[model samples]
Every structure is written in C-alpha cells, then in structure tokens.
Target: MILEAVVLQVKKGMEAEYEKAFRGASKIISSMNGYISHELQRCMEVEGKYLLLVQWETLEDHTVGFRQSTEYQEWKKRLHHFYDPFPTVEHFEKVYTLES
Candidate 1:
C-alpha cells in the first residue's frame, strides 16, 4: 500500500468554502481504483492549512490511474481554485507501525 499526502493552503477567507467543496469532491477520489481510504485534517495552529491523506494500493493507482482519468478533471474543477499556491502532493510507504 502507499500513502498520498498533501499540505493544502487555502486562499484567505475561503476555508469554509474549501471544506464544503472538498466534502462534495470526496466522492470523486473515494471511487477511484485502488483507493483504500482518505482523510482531510485541518491544522489547529494555522487558519487556512490542511493535510490531505489518501491510501492507495500502489503509487500508480494515484499518479497514473486517478490523475490521468477524466474524473480528475471534475475533481480539479471542484477543488483546485480554492488553493492559494497549489499544493505539492507526495507519496509514501509505511516504514513501521505500532498498531495493536
């Protein structure tokens, strides 16, 4: 499995609108191939910062499958404008876990 992470900095005063848009756009990603789960975490210290985490079966599932699909166009249309400087998304693999 792989994890996709992005630090989103929403444009000033658009936080509420961004969240609303994200909720509506979530379906687009959740339905993609190899999608496991995802979460959008708001930063406590920062007024317009958020962390988006998505789990996929493989990196290509996101980089190729999702990003290249037409659904991505919809996703971008729904959420991209809310961002200030566009977020840089990164991928990761679990190095260790302490789950019980």
Candidate 2:
C-alpha cells in the first residue's frame, strides 16, 4: 500500500469553511482508481491545522492517475483556496509495523 500524507495549514477563521469543502472533495478522491481510504484529521494543538492521510494501492495511482485526472481539478477548486500557502504532499511505503 502507498500512504499519501498532507499537512494542511488552513487560513485563520477559514477552518470551518475548509472542513466543509473537504467533505465534498473527499468524495472525489475516494472514488478514484486504486483508492483504498482516506482521513482528514484536525490538529488539537494548533488552530486551522489538519492532516490528510490517503491510502492507495500504488504510488502512481495518486501521482499520475488522480493528480492528472479531471476529478483532481474539482478537488482543487473545492479545497485549494482554503490553504494559506498550499500543502506539501508526501508519499510513503510500509517499512515496519507491529500489531497484536
């Protein structure tokens, strides 16, 4: 699995609106090919901070498939304006894990 992580810094006072927009945007991403799941988590210690974690079957499923698709345009229209300086998205692969 591929993990796509984004740390979003929303503009002050725009958090509520951002969250609302993200709700709609989530539908766009979750429907994409190779999409496993996703989560939008709010930061308790910092105002207007959020973490967006998305799981994909492969890296290209996001970097090439989703990012290049027309759906991504809609996603950007819904959520991009809320960001103060834009978020940096990073991808990762499983290295180690422990479970009982």
lDDT tens digits by residue: candidate 1, 34-69: 999999999999999999999999999999999999
RMSD of each: 0.6, 0.6
Model 2 segments beyond 4 Å from truth? none
lDDT agreement with native, every candidate? 0.97, 0.94
Model 1, stretches more than 4 Å misplaced?
A: none
Global Cα lDDT for candidate 1: 0.97
Backbone collision count in every prediction? 0, 0
lDDT of 2 by residue, 18-86 (tens): 888898788899999999999999999999999999999999999999999999999988889999878
